[model samples]
Target chain A: MKKAVFIKEGQVAIKDAPMPEIIEQDDAVIRVVRTCVCGSDLWAYRGDDAKEAGSDNSGHEIIGIVEKVGAAINTVKAGDFVIAPFTHGCGHCAACRAGFEGGCQSHSAATNFSNGYQAEYVRYTHADWSLVKIPGQPDDYSEGMLKSFLALADVMPTGYHAARVANVKAGDTVAVVGDGAVGLCAVIAAKLRGAKRIIIMSRHEDRQQLALEFGATDVVAERGEEGIAKVLELTNGDGVDAALECVGTHLSTETAIAIARPGAVVGRVGVPHTGDINVGDYFMKNTIFAGGPASVTTYDKAVLLKAVLDGDINPGKVFTQTYKLSDIDQAYKDMQERKTIKAMITID
Target chain B: MKKAVFIKEGQVAIKDAPMPEIIEQDDAVIRVVRTCVCGSDLWAYRGDDAKEAGSDNSGHEIIGIVEKVGAAINTVKAGDFVIAPFTHGCGHCAACRAGFEGGCQSHSAATNFSNGYQAEYVRYTHADWSLVKIPGQPDDYSEGMLKSFLALADVMPTGYHAARVANVKAGDTVAVVGDGAVGLCAVIAAKLRGAKRIIIMSRHEDRQQLALEFGATDVVAERGEEGIAKVLELTNGDGVDAALECVGTHLSTETAIAIARPGAVVGRVGVPHTGDINVGDYFMKNTIFAGGPASVTTYDKAVLLKAVLDGDINPGKVFTQTYKLSDIDQAYKDMQERKTIKAMITID
Candidate 1:
């Protein structure tokens, strides 16, 4: 089997690795069909966040075919095509029961994939609850449907988490604070939740166009104070009813908070990497700040899978570029240099 | 007429002031029947918060009789007994319509009281919406009922706001940080919302006893880390489902956040006076932080008034001492020295 490895900052390589096998009673081994590079993965690739050199298991999202299952794995079995949520859970834990599988308490590690899904084969622990079986094999679905199914593993669900936490409702005016794939997905999420007006902040023309296509009603190219001013102006100086913060930076977070109307919520889904947050500002407006890692398993089972199957949302459009497992390095490079919105990788 | 004035740190004076008249068509003049000292008022009294010397509008809460009304004040008129919420609103602005009167726009100031409620006569702005009419005159209710009506003006509703923001549900576990009048009221708020276990932090035996009487099931005397540990231990390490922050200090806020379970909300109603909040901690737990000044007008008209009128709650018990208007200085002194939980002033 071959897997992606992080050699150092700005460098990734696909190297031969041992084949994955079920090691626990609840485990299952799957042959990877599709995987992708995440914006979060870029944190380490760009040297902004540290990762040990020569580390494998470089990616988390996976749409694969289950090849084998341990004794206790009853929900999914061999020959089943599945979507594996990046964050796994036991489904029965208190947190999971409450729809927060990312904080599942019964698992030793919420995510238990051997050698990462960015490989020819991967082992998933607590397989019964972590993997969502598709109605048919990969061969039965169109290429576009397959891409949308792949998105359900993380990005689409993560973006939906922001809208859900913000309680974006019908007739709401929503503001999205990033132009990344997750932000574009959030535009869809906001629209799905019936938000009447969606304003997206995006400097890149291609990303802005995708956001508009994803249901964003307006676009503000400005950043920081100017961006907040632009959003407030768009909303007639009343600020947005809900703000989705998909960028994990102080300025982005600040802009999200600043553009939210009094008594509105700001749902932040970006992995935080910012300085002190002035809670006083949130306090004054009675703004509710809610969010964290996406509950991928819950959302995938409840909404995203159905939405994708029905072709109600085309989240796969976020993938502007594609590659094979052998070309993993160039995939990372293209995403890192802003040459592509996202990279989709296919493995055989 | 006599009104209380801030003389300096640790001092208050009852001085003769001019009679208040309705300046705006939306204003009304009331003969203050009962008023009280608040925990927030203590900030300026202790010199921790700045206030201009000799400021005469030294208080906000009031239970009074409408003695005069401007042309536009139709809902409340002369001879009506009313509860004047400290935070006034026009009742029709977007923020007010959404039940956040503290952020009400269209008014020059959300609070519009002349010469303070502690005076013999107080003028209220946006009178039609700011005043909740009692069924009968002051003479019709007992002293305890009047005290509770005054409590509805601020502390009771403010504490209820904490519980409301946290979304306390049936069978939930709630932890309250702060044991002042507002915190004590939060215990009642939590119980009213059907919390199964209500834990309150209080070192004072007097406050602890009152909290228990009000519906708190557990008491943690420790502060800071120990307090958080004690709460976690009580909940079997799962932490409380809702944490109500009633004390506006960094340590109090930190304690509230630390004892909340994953996906829980920390409802903060304390007037914030702290440094940067570590939003990263909140992010890791998917905790939602929401709150601001209580929507007293909304709560008073919708719930607190009926609750008090029906004798369903006795929030007035928080007022442990009584004083005549002439003893305004003594009221501040006793409250400052911790000799009283709250001071109830009678104007004759």
Candidate 2:
């Protein structure tokens, strides 16, 4: 089976990799229907071995049909449609019980080659817990926004979780840093969560425009001091009640902190690389800093799936382009160039 | 009016600073009855120039009797008894609405010591919002463990808030780093929150013993990697479900992270100085980090006050010694020398 693998630093390729099979009684083998590039996947693609790395099947945000299941598996079975979150997790791990599905303990979800998630057909472990079965076949798969659901599977809920952790409230103003898909998602999320005003800080015109559509009550095009000042200006010089950082860069993280009013919270979901996780401003501001990776598995993914299924939300807007599994390089280039927000690929 | 001012680092003396008056339409003048030395005070006492030179009003934790009120003030009036949390707060601020009362906008409890609680007669700016009045007590000053409430005014509730921020649940195993008053209080708070097994990481026999009395199921005297190893060993090598860092040192902060299982939360209430706020392990461990200066005002202090008042909990055990207000120098010395866990100074 053709699968994506990281040959070395700065290289990703679709090569003939070994097919996967059920290893646990609660395991199932899923034939990949679709896969996509995630911001978290860029760490190794960009030669940054800092945040996460692996060569295994590189995609966990998968939409697939279960090809087979173990004898003991009961929740999901052969021929069932499902949305696989970024991790294959055991339901019983402390981390799993604590409401973090991405850190599932039983089945390693990283590169099976090294610790990747991209593959043709990969073994889905702890099937009862890891796979979210999509109910009743729809006439149009694209209409279902399955690709978007795959995308939403992690970053979307992550944005919402960031807001939840920061405890953003109704009539409160929240500023979002980093106009990545997650940031864009957070704009919608903060609005959905009842924030009276949502602000997005970004220089990208496209993202800024998207931020507005997604529910950014305001957008700050400035960076650093100017950006912080702009946020405070929108917030009556008191700063935001909550700041959501969706971009993992140092500048974005610090802006989230600097723009925070004292006692407010800064929810950071961006995966930071080599940079100071500054807490000096964080301490002086006396702010609550919450958020890590999204606990995609711990909470109910069905709610998000239903939103996508019902067309109430269209997260698929993030996938601005697409590619065949073999044209993975162009997909990477398109994403790196920022010409595309994200890319979807056909596994077949 | 007589006020206690820090003339310089390590030099504290009572002097005629400024007459108490309403600075804002919402201000009030409170006749401070008892203001205790807070753990956070040691920051300024150890020569924080910003505090020493700015507004040397030394305490944020105070129990006082309201002497005067602005016409607009409605929460309390002349002769009302109250306890001020660590920071002066305006109840109407966005930060306050979001439940972060420590960083209120209308009244900044202590921006600098230019205005402080550590004075004979203190001027409270957000008198309507910042003060919590004691119920049913006008003259019974010495009966309700006001000193303990004052002592915990910052640390205890701060510790409780730290655990709350970490999202500790019943049946969860939690590890507490730091054996100071905050740390000790965290042990009880963790138990109150239904933590099944509370572990205290400390070398001090007194603190460790107190932790046991406070409902800690286990105590670890080891430090650093070894201490973390013990914590992991106790949890069958996975690590505690939640960990709290009440001591804000780099070591304690690192240990809190080290001992937390992936997907677990490391709630750090410790006030950090210059130290590596390590995220390398956190990014991989995928630990959720939350907590900063606790929002004691965000919690039900009255319930805690009742607990102290009813003697359901004896947080007063922390006050090992007391001195007359004239012997405050000795109180500091006792606390500094570790001869007393905490010392109270009485004013006649």
Candidate 3:
């Protein structure tokens, strides 16, 4: 079957690869249905992350149908539509028990996407804690409906957790950095959390329009100081009560810290590439900073999943472009050029 | 009247000065009843903090008798014994109302300790919100119970606020960084907050003994990695649930971060003196780092004052040495040589 493999470096291509096998007792083999590209994916493709020795697979955001399950997998069975959230989480660990399953101790599911689909089939270890089964029609779930919430497996929920960790309360104003798919989702998530005003910082016109529709009360097109000034102007110089920084670059992180009001918080979900992270800049303001891997298992997946079934938040708006599995490289190009917010590939 | 002046850098002397006079409707004149020297005071005496052009006065923690009140000072009577919490607070800023009165918008009254006592009397602006008056106290309150709850003005409440801002919960294991007066106070504060295991990292035998008396479950005499390893070994390799960093240097800050579990929080109250801070290595741990200046006005000063009155918590244990006003220079030297944890000087 075709899988998106990092053939050498700096490029991704769909090529024939050996199918994954269920070696773990609680593993589940998922037949790929729909998968989306992630921002973290660019870390390797852009030569920002360390490259693998032989070949590396490149996808963690997966929505698929279960084709097989280990004998211990009673919670989910074959022929069910499901989403794999976080990377992998052991059912028990100090972090998991404390509701921070995203930083699970014993598993490296997402980081080891070598076992995931950018392919036709993916094996999920600790399947009981990894897979969330979709309750509705298994045979007829389309990208429109699945993308609305299935994407919550990672992006939507991850960004929402960022806002939540920053303690975004009702009627509080929020500043969302990086106006990408995750940033737009955070705008929607902040609105869901009852944020009275959400200001999204973006340079792209299409993403800005989407941000406005998805509940952004204001938009700042400028980057850094100019953008922070616009946010301060909108927030009456009091600065934002909270910020969700989706882009992990130093620039976005600085902007997030710059725009937040003292005693407020910045939920930084951006995966920092190799760079110095400054926490002193936030000292006098009393800002609370918390964000790492999204604790996807901690939240009630179905609660957010319901917002989709109720047709309230259209997270699928981020899926601006679609392609077949064979043309995955072009999809990466669209995302790299910022021409597409994110890409959805049909993979039945 | 006489004033204490740092005549030469690192040297303090008593000199003739004028008595303080009320300058505004929110002002009050307080006769210095009792004052203690903080480690921060030694910063400028040792040429650490920024020095003003030929400036005098260093003390910020003062317990005094209100000698006069302005037209708007309705909170206390002229003859009241009060705790001067801030250098000054307007009591109306957003930060004030939200209880972060230390960072009040009009920061005029924030830290104007240059006009502080090293003198017979001190001028207090915004008397209504800046002072905490003891309900029942006789004249010469200093010689008797003045030292009891007065730590609430700065050290005691400041230490507790450091733990509180991180939202330290019941049964949490806490690590206290720094062995200064504030660090010892943090041991007491974290204990009061119901930390199950309180570990004090200190090399000083006196401070360690004080920490044990203040309810420390354990003590790690090591400083950096050895100290962090001891703390982790105590917690089964999971590290502390919360950390209070009372020393603000990069080393102390890193120590606090090194000793907490993922999702644990570190509340820091010490003011950073120099160098950039780095938390990039700590990003993956998902720790919530917060804290700044102790918002003494933000906490229940009256409640804590009552606690001191009830003899439930004795904060005066931190003052290991005493002196007359004439011997203050020697007191500063005693503190610098680490012979005393804190010094108490009497004006009379």
Candidate 4:
């Protein structure tokens, strides 16, 4: 099997690796059909995260076809096209039942997909609960639909999680604090939730235009205090009813909190890069702070899959550039250099 | 007029002060009918909070007779028996209309009652929206009823804020991290919100009994990690659905977050005495953190007043000791030394 490996800082290589097999009674072997490089992958690529050099596995999102299943896996069968959610919930735990599979009590490393989904073959555990079977194989759908299905594996649900956690409601004015792929998806999510207006902070021209097309009502091309000022100005100084923080830096987190109105919520989906937050800021305004990894399994099984099937959302647009599996290094390079919004990888 | 003054650490005194008069067109002069020493007062009494000695105007809670009104004060008038909430909201601001008057954008010092409600008279600005007029004068109600009304001025509404922020629902299990007047009141708040079980953390025997009387279903007399462990044990290790932080220290706040189940909310009503919080702790569990000063003006007008008048609650029970206005020093001493849960001050 060909899998993506972290060679060292600033380098990722597709190398021949041992094929994955069904190790757990609930596990299944999947032949990867589609995968993508995530923004979080850049953290290690830039030498910011603590991932060790020469680590073999990478990537957490995937749309795959089940090649084999353990005897105990009854829900999914071989030859089934499936979406493997990043957080593989067991479906019965309190956390999973409550729609927070990201914090599943019965979670194991196998459920995390840390073995690298950006490969020709991968092992999926908790298959019965985590794998959402698509109605047909990848060849049955348009290119756009396939990308949207792949998105349900992680980013789309993550974006929706931000909107849900922020308690976005009809008639709310929302401010999104990043212009990355996830933030663009959040714009679509905000619209799906019926937000009256969405002001996205973006400095990149292409990203800003994409955000507008994705349902952002306005854009603020500023950063820091200036960005907050611009957002507040757009809302007539009342700040936004909900703020979506899609960037993980301290400044981004602070901007999200600052842009929220009194009694508003700041939904932070970005992985935090900073240590501590001055909670007194939220306390003084009575702002609600909530967010974490997307409950992809729950959302996919509940709404995202149906929404995608029904054409209610087209998250596939986030992938501005695509590449064959052999061009993996170039895909990472383009995304890292800000040359692409997101990179989609096609496997053979 | 006589009013409570901070003499120094461990000391408070009743001294002559200027009589209050309607200073703003939206102001009203309320002759204090009843007042009380607050738990927050003990912070200053213990010299933990910065305060200049001999500074007058100490208390914030009051149920009184409106003695005079500025020309614009039409909602409340002279001779009207009123519950002057600790936060005097203008009622028309965005924060107030949203039921979060504690962060009212139109706030002024007069609306805060920082001039002192323990005095013979208080000049309450934002009177039109800030004061809740009772049906009759103080003489028409029993001492218990008056005490309940006084509780609505701050503690009861403040406690209710915690439960409201925690999003407590019917059949939910709630954990309260403090056992002071506010925490005990929160026990009642949780019950009123239809929580199936209420766990209160209290080491004091008297307070534990009082908490039980106030609807606490269980008591954990432990502290720190052990306290969290006990709470988890009470909930069968799933942790409470909602955790109320009535104590503002870092440890208390951490305990509230630690004992909540995945995706639960930690409602903190206590004024935070610490600086920063490790937000990652909350992010990991998708726990919602929401709280601040009670929107006393909003809660009192919306529900607390009716609840008290209907005899649905008797928050007055929190006042375990009584003191003549002249014995202000002893009142502070008793509350500081933990000799009483709360002290009621009577003005003659």
Candidate 5:
């Protein structure tokens, strides 16, 4: 089987790898149908993540068909269409039972001992707790519908998590800091959550257009203090009720904090690259900083699926570029070059 | 008039100062009936806050009798017994209207261009917005009642703020990191908010006794990782639903985060001395970090006043040592030496 491998800094290639098999009682073998490059992947691709330059599995977001299920797996069966969250969890753990599968006791994202999903076949452990089965058959969904469903595995749910943790409510004024696919999805999530005014910070015209289409009431094209000034101006100097830090940089987090109103919450879903935060400023403003990794299992994926199926949201629009499995290297180049918001990979 | 001055890094003294008078239309001249040394005051006393080594008015917490009111003052008048929140605000500002007076547009804690409360007579700006009147005449309350009311100025309200921001609810298990008066008050606040179990981390037997008396179900005598381990063990390794960070150090904040359950909130009211936070660990746990300087003006001071008046809580008990106005230096020394939980200063 062919899988994406991290060749070295600024390079990636396709290589033949051993086929994955079910090794645990709750494990399952899945044939990858669709996957994508996450912003976090850029860390390793740039050699900044300290990952040795070698052949290693990449990509965590995946939509696939269960080719085989372990005998212990009861909730899902072979031939089922499934969506795997970015992180896996053991079903019966206290954290999982409390609806925070991201903090699963036995199995978590840190202990991803299995192979990545950027391959033809992958082994998934704790299948009963980690995989969410799609209700309908593959024949019942269109190509776009399948792509949108794939977002439930990571980005879309992550955006929703940002809104949920920020306690975004009806009539709230929200600001999304970043123009990437996740930030755009946050605008949609805020809108879906009933935010009355959505402000998006974007520099690109194309991303701005998508943001507006996704329900951003306004867009601030500036960066740093100027961007915060624009948001405060839009909010009549009071700042937004909620701010979503979609870009993991310190500047973005600072901007999010700057534009949040007193008692407002700044929800960050971006993988933070910056270490320290200006806690002193945060204290004086009386703002609440919330959010981290999205607990996809805790989110109401079923409701989101219904919303997608009913044509309420088209998150697939974020897939500005697409590529066949053989052209995975080109996909990475396009994403790294900023030519695409997100690169959709077709593995089947 | 006389007032407490920050003469040097390790010293405080009572010195003659000018008599205060109303300067702004909404200002008031109040005769400070009582005042106290706050835990944060030690920051400046210890030379950690970089305050100039010269005479500058000190304390912020005060209960007083209105001596005179400006023409624009409507909510309060001369002869009214009142308590001033630690921070002031323009009641009409967006932040003030939203119940976050600490972030008021025209007024904030930093712009204390006005005089401090540690004086015989001090001018107060935004009198109508900053002062909350006691229900009855000054003569009707006992010495303990007045001290408890003074606690509402900062410590009690700040503790309550921690629990409030953490979203402490009925049946929740809470852990308070710190054994100071504010931390003990947080234990009381958590109990009042209906927390089923309250855990307080304290090394001092006196503080632990106060914590237990204030409704702490368990007291962990350990510090740092050991303290967190004790809390985790007490919670059956599930961790507490809410953790109040009453100590403003990195170790305290880390311990608070470590003992928090997934989806839990760590509410911090301490003036944070530790700069950066471990965003990576925070993200992996799916925890929410919320809180800042407690908006004392946002709290329902009337409820706290009533509780004190009715003998429901004895926050005054935390003031184990008392001194007359002329003995202000002794008060500061006792607090500086950690020989007292808090110091009470009688101005009359």
Candidate 6:
């Protein structure tokens, strides 16, 4: 089997690797159908994350078909198409039962699951709890619907998590602080929540256009203080009711905080690059900072899946570029260079 | 008029000061009938907060009789007894209307209203917006009622603000990270909000007693990680639903986050002595960091006031020590030395 491997900083390649097999009672072997490059992947690609080059499996978001199921797996069967949440969990843990599967006590993103989905086959543990079966036959869905289904695995659910935790309401003015796939999807999520006005902070024309198409009412190309100023101006100087900090940089978080109204919530979903949160800045403003890795398994995937099927939201529009598994290197390059908003990978 | 002055970092003295008079259309002159030393005041007394000795007015919490009212002051008039929120606001600003008087547009804690309540007469700006009437004649209430009324000015209201922003819902298990007046009051607030169990972290026997009396179901004397461990153990290892960081130190905030359940809210009302918030710690925990300087003027003062009048709560019990106007130095010393939980100063 061929899987994406990290050769070194600024390098990723598809190489021959051993095939994954069901090793646990709840494990399942899946044939990879679709996968994608997440913003967090760039951390290791850039050598910022402590992940050693050419070590461990890569990629988390996955949409695949169950080729085999372990003895204990009852929820999913062979030949079923499924969406795998980025983080796997044990269904019966206290945290999982409380709807925080991402922080599940039995198995978590930081501790378990090692195979990457950018390959012909992958092993998924706790399949019954970690995988949600897609409704309907694969042949009945359109290509766009398939792409949107792939989003439910990570990006779309993550964006919805941002909007949900920020408490975006029907009359709220929302600001999304990134223009990447998750940020664009957040625009869709905010609109779904009935936001009165949606502002996207983006510097690139393509992303800005995608943002508007996804439901952004306005776009601010400025960065830092200027971007905050633009948002404040649009909000009549009171600032937006909710802000989604989808870019993990300190500046992005600061801008999100600065452009939020008193008592507004700034929900941050991006993998953070910095550890500092200016206590004085948020303390004085009465801002509520909420968010983390999205608990995709806990989100109302059925509702979002329905929305996609019903043509209410096209989160798949974020896939501005796509490539086969053989072109994984180029896909990473396009995404790293900001030449593509997001790259979708088709596995055969 | 006699008022308390900070002669030096470790010194406070009652000395003659100019009598206050209404200077603005929305201003009112109040005769200080009761005032108390706040936990935040200890910051300057301990030389932690930067304050030039004898440089500015001192004290913020006060219960007083309206000595006189400006032409525009409609909510309060001469002879009315009222409780003043520590922070004053214009009331008509967007932030104020949003129930964040601490961040009011026209006037804020950062910009104006420096006159302290530890004086015979103090000028209160935005009188109509900052003052809450006691709903009865001063002579009709008992001494305990007056002390409880004084709590409404800062401690009680600030504690309620912490619980309110933390989103304490019925059946929630709440952990208070401090056991001072504010923390004890937070216990009361949590109970009023229908929290199922309240845990207070405190080593002092007196404070722990007060916490239990105020409705704490458990008390953990441990500090730092040990404290968090105790809280987690008490909650059957799931951690509390809401954590109130009533102590401003970074350790307190970190502990608050550490002991909170995933998706829990850590409400902080302590005047922050540290400016750092570890984004990674909270980001991974899915913790919602909410709170700031309490917008006491926006709180349901009428309900709290009625509670006190009806003997439903005895927040005044936190005021374990009292002093005459001339004993201002002793009051500061006792509070600074932790000999008393809080100090009440009689200005008559």
* TM-scores for the candidates: 0.95, 0.85, 0.92, 0.97, 0.94, 0.95
Q: List the residue pairs that clash in candidate 1.
A: none
DockQ of 1: 0.59
DockQ of all models, two decimals each: 0.59, 0.42, 0.47, 0.63, 0.53, 0.56
Cα deviation of A314, candidate 4, in Å: 0.5
Q: Which 10 successive residues of model 4 chain A have the least lDDT summed?
A: A107-116
- Taking the tens digit of each residue's C-alpha lDDT, what string does model 1 give over A1-348? 898989899998888888887788988898889999998888789997788977864588889999999999889889999998887778876567767777666765535322356888888888888789889889999888888988988899989999998989999899999999999999999999999999999999999999999999999999988888888888777788889999988888888888987788889999887688867666867888999878888888888899999989999999888899999989999999999998999984
TM-score of chain B of 6: 0.96
**Whole-model Cα lDDT per candidate?**
0.87, 0.71, 0.77, 0.86, 0.82, 0.83
Error of 6 at B94 (Å): 3.0
lDDT tens readout by residue for model 4, B1-348: 998888888888878888887777988888998899998787778988889977854578888899999999778778999988888777776677777887787775445544466778888878888888899788899999988999998899989999998989899999999999999999989998899999999999999999898899999999999999999888777788899999888888889988988888889999887566867556768888989878887788778888888988899999989889999789888988899899999996
Better of 3 and 5 by TM-score: 5
Runs off by more than 4 Å, candidate 4: A108-115, B108-115
> Which structure among the candidates has the greatest TM-score?
4
Candidate 6 residues B268-316, lDDT tens each? Answer: 9986765567665567778898898787877745468778878888999
lDDT of 2 at B100: 66
Clashing pairs in 3: A87-A110, B4-B118
Put the candidates in lDDT order, highest first. Answer: 1, 4, 6, 5, 3, 2
In model 3, how large is the Cα lDDT of residue A205? 92
Q: Worst 10-residue stretch by lDDT in candidate 3 chain A?
A: A107-116
Best by DockQ: 4
TM-score of 5: 0.94
Badly placed stretches (over 4 Å) of model 1 are A108-115, B50-52, B108-115
**B1-348 per-residue lDDT for model 2 (tens digits):** 655555555655655657678877677787776665666666656665356354564556667778898987998888887766665556677767756666566654454112366667767765666667777544665634776666556767877877887888899899999888888888878887899999999888988888999999999999998998999899987788889888877788778878888767777777776276744335545666666666665564545676666766667677777766656656665776678777665565
Q: Which ten residues in a row have the lowest lDDT in candidate 1 chain B?
A: B107-116
Instruction: Give candidates' CA RMSD values in order.
Output: 2.2, 4.2, 2.9, 1.6, 2.5, 2.2
Model 5 segments more than 4 A misplaced: A9-11, A46-54, A91-94, A112-115, A275-281, B8-11, B44-54, B112-115, B275-281, B301-303, B309-311
Native-to-model Cα distance after best TM-score fit, residue B3 in candidate 5, in Å: 2.2
TM-score of chain B of each: 0.97, 0.89, 0.93, 0.97, 0.95, 0.96
